[model samples]
Target: MTVRSAWLLPGGTDSPGQTREDTRLAPVGTMLPDGELGTRPGVIPGGDPFAATGAGAMSLQVATGRAQVQGTAAQGAYPVCLDAPEVVTFADGDAQFDRIDTVCLHVYDALFDTAGQNLAAVEVIVGSATDTPTAPTLDPACLPLWDVRVPAGASAGVGGIDWTSALTDRRRYTAAVGGIVPRGALSDVGAYDGQYADVEGLLYRWSTADDEWQLYRAPELPVETITDGADTATGWTLNSFDARRHGRVVQILGYWVRSGETLTTNPNIADTLIATLPTGWRPVVLVEAIASNGYGFGAVAIGTDGKLTVRSWAGGEKANALEKDTNVRVAATFVQ
Candidate 1:
């Protein structure tokens, strides 16, 4: 194929001499300009495209499909399409040893070949028979779609291939240029550092250092209404009580009024149980925070048993007392 220049120039006049290479180079040029060459080759997402199914005997059938491949810049990109379902047959299994084979889409370009024939076809690349069989190596122009395991002495009858479990779907998908990849299409978590994927409505970023997908944003945790219990039993009316967790941190927000009798001289008044957090919401260890108690500031502690206890009051004439009919506020944050 002759390399053409000045093909996609702006304000260029149309010519009847345009060939298939001209049309193919247009999209490839568009994708290349935006650093999209780094985008992995894959099938377009939906319609169960290119699904492989067992077809009797030693044959396997592939559904109609479409895929994108980033071949060398000299060869340009390939938008491969299968107009109709194609059946691929494999050689029968070895009589005494199991083998593995790979189904792949192979791209043939005249630019890189001695024969000036350009074509794209689906081919089954057979593997070597071995006690521990492995899939075959693919050419740079080939994209794998599935792996088939042929058991020892397997054939068309009672010991034929078990279509149910012998086939492994190796299909993966690529996103539109600059779009977030779907989590299901991520075959290598560490392939692209900082790549983002949408996982169940949440965004996750690939972390190559950790070899994992880390949450890209702060997670939205459900705010739970704190049920009034021990504090209410002592004539304390809760105004607003809520709790929420973000990762390992749990935060509490609450307000209440001591409307009933308040102990003025009781030394044990600091051990007042206000409420209990739910099992999973409790802190890992005792955590304390300062809160407003009547006319003074008081210490509040949350224990591992989920108990919220009032420690003691300061900044008031009454050392450890809670005046009646006074308002109190509680706001604490701790690691669970």
Candidate 2:
């Protein structure tokens, strides 16, 4: 067999002085080795150099600047030659990935600080370019300025305005502004209730029934009946009576009916029967009970010891003239 190596020269054309033989050139594969032909083993363009035919040694050195590249390889492992972008300097911590469509980076307990102080104390950043961070401003009025937390297995309570803690066992904090301005229902004074701090023109308390704190004011007194030592004989009864205190005066109004025996005088009757009277106030000639008929009349007088005496009197300046079958209305007022 004869072998020939043919080289084609450029700018050759069949026209003018160019020959036809110059335009004709043999393929480079015609000179390839027999084992490298076709798609069989050891073929030049068939098998991959890094795979079935065994990979060749490759060493890369990046001195300065950057090299841009792009490509893809197997899924699980890193490729021998990574496709990169135009500017990539590993020493300067700069990297670019051309083939990756998206990249995600996650950080745990990431700290950003200036002069060793937390970033939260410094300027609040709103947006981020690489990590996509975000921050939202909060409204202080929408939340409590301070919250008191009762730790587990511990108890905590806030004292009212001017409320003093026990000297030995309690911790106290005095607020210049009295207690909290309660909202909702109000509570009345009780045996265990503490004194409220003086507000210039406001009052507040806790309503045990309503289960909420509320603004409060002085309440009206309720009508209470004289339950004990009341006359309950046949046809003799004391009807409903109302008693109330307003500012410095206490008032009582009621009616009683008697049909059996004539009434007698007793100095301690008012003190014993009317337990609703406020302290330090004795019935002073204050009680006057007159019957519906013009025949019966009664009177009450207070002694120096704040005790009262009840006596029946007549129209002729006679005393103890109270007769049977008489209905008398009694009304009196006292300074408290």
Candidate 3:
């Protein structure tokens, strides 16, 4: 018998043997002459075909072998599967999926927020039973324009950062330089009784243990230069009164010289409260003066309508009227 007749061809017993005119011989357990064995031409490798497509493209399923296609064409992007819990990993580098319309994948162990929103775009798993692909880690420098992160404090009650409140009904405290918290009402009697808060630039703080919120010195005291406004040519010495702010109070500390020199028409009013205190601010306490001349003592008081009166005396109880060189030093506190 000839070599073609000795072979068992793929057609059934009702079909004839391989004829001499037929150049392509396909058998049950042999490779095709061009090394492919699927429904379409130049498609699969190994033995049997898996499933047929309407476009005549057949899937190659392996019982114990792999069917790899290595080409740049669109038909070369076929997935290889193994038997029973075996994972088929693609080769490294960009294995392009050409002209794919829709892709549906199943992700495991994803995270979500309280409002049922996905927390991450893609999650990286470290290790799996079948595959050990390198997982990715987080990097802060690569954040998007509007990325959300969960802070690790009392403010994390809601779903992460408040992006919606910042977009819609924004508040001034939410954008403060030193950072801010939500506006909280002053407690009646608590540990935070004297604490302060800023609501849209309106300052408010607790007064006492049992008090509600009150405006905590809103309009700051204007910085005033307390000079005698005297000319150097007149040979008249100038007095100094320096004021500085410390929280809700102001501390005025300076020295006043009772320039005892003889007067030429009052010489621009010496040591008689030569400054205008702001409307709602006045001295609340005046410490004792460190006497220098005259029978001195120091006195500072605030009128009921917010007026600042500063005085100094020496050698006993006396009025604040100054005589030449009868200097007196004073320290006082004021509040708004």
Candidate 4:
């Protein structure tokens, strides 16, 4: 075992913990029911279509841990509902979010009636969530609705920071963001109802009677989201939140890295990486920091003698070579 294996052995599991992984998720809306995943409204108790319907209506359900909703073609300007608690309950119910996550807006290409016309811009409003006016004609920079092209035949769904999910539970409400709709419908299109566009957006309503969760897709408000930051090494366009970093125990904070056979690296590289990043932003490095945490994978420095001999790695800890001058440690020079 070399110096790397010594500390890599495990400091015991990192205490049974739950990572909120950042409780915010960007809210997104779109007109088409195809790609944008959300729980659509009015699905029967058995996942059947309801006889009744409403404007900009669609289907909604919880799948593989996401509250997914689907949209349709005849959609009018309506807000989509999301049942955060139910979807969230599937994961860690204790996860709490104080502010709205980044909103994920989508105006499905189908929602646009622009035959051959070009789009100028889109608008968004943090309706109902705040005392602010409903569907306030927000500016472009302020709204995340710029360049959002609603293809000739797709539905529209907008997303961004709305601030409606943070209601106090029977104890606190999930921090909910407002609407993610279109900009003036862009033409003689529908007017922004400032109401819930899809039934899915109103999935989880607070029950004052039982003091728990209930279901309702009222046209109105909501938002929370999490993502894996670990590295897969399989070469996916690494996002800043990978759950693991390849195999090294060094990616706990999220940064890009590579290694060489006879080269050197700092054991405290994590601290250094964190020091270099901006204030609230973390590097895109993730690792199986503690055992029982992930794939339980590892690496070792082997010796030619076939014995796992532990050598001193002064590579970055001390000097260039621990066996030579005490001041000249670190760099391994070569490996057996």
Greater-lDDT candidate between 1 and 3: 1
Model 2, range 119-216, lDDT digits (tens) per residue? 00101111122232222232110110111111112112221111021011111111212223221113323111222422335665544465444556
Q: What TM-scores do the predictions have?
A: 0.54, 0.24, 0.23, 0.14
The top-ranked prediction according to TM-score is 1
Which regions in candidate 2 have their CA more than 4 angstroms from the true location?
1-236, 264-294, 302-309, 316-320
Clashing pairs in 1: none
Tell me the tens digit of each residue's lDDT in model 3 across 1-336: 000111111221222331222212222122112113221112233343222111111111112222221222222211222221111111112122111010011111112112122111111111111222222232211111111111222122233223332111111111111222234333322123444554456666654554566766655655654323222112223366566665547555555564434222232223344234444345454333233334545354444344334443333333333445654555656554
Q: Which 10-residue window of candidate 4 scores lowest in summed lDDT?
A: 1-10
Estimate the lDDT of model 1: 0.67
Worst 10 residues of 2 by lDDT: 100-109
Local error of candidate 3 at 257, Å? Answer: 2.1
Candidate whose lDDT is highest? 1
Give the Å shift of residue 284 in candidate 1. Answer: 34
**Cα TM-score of candidate 3:** 0.23
Query: Alpha-carbon error at 8 in model 1, in Å?
Result: 24
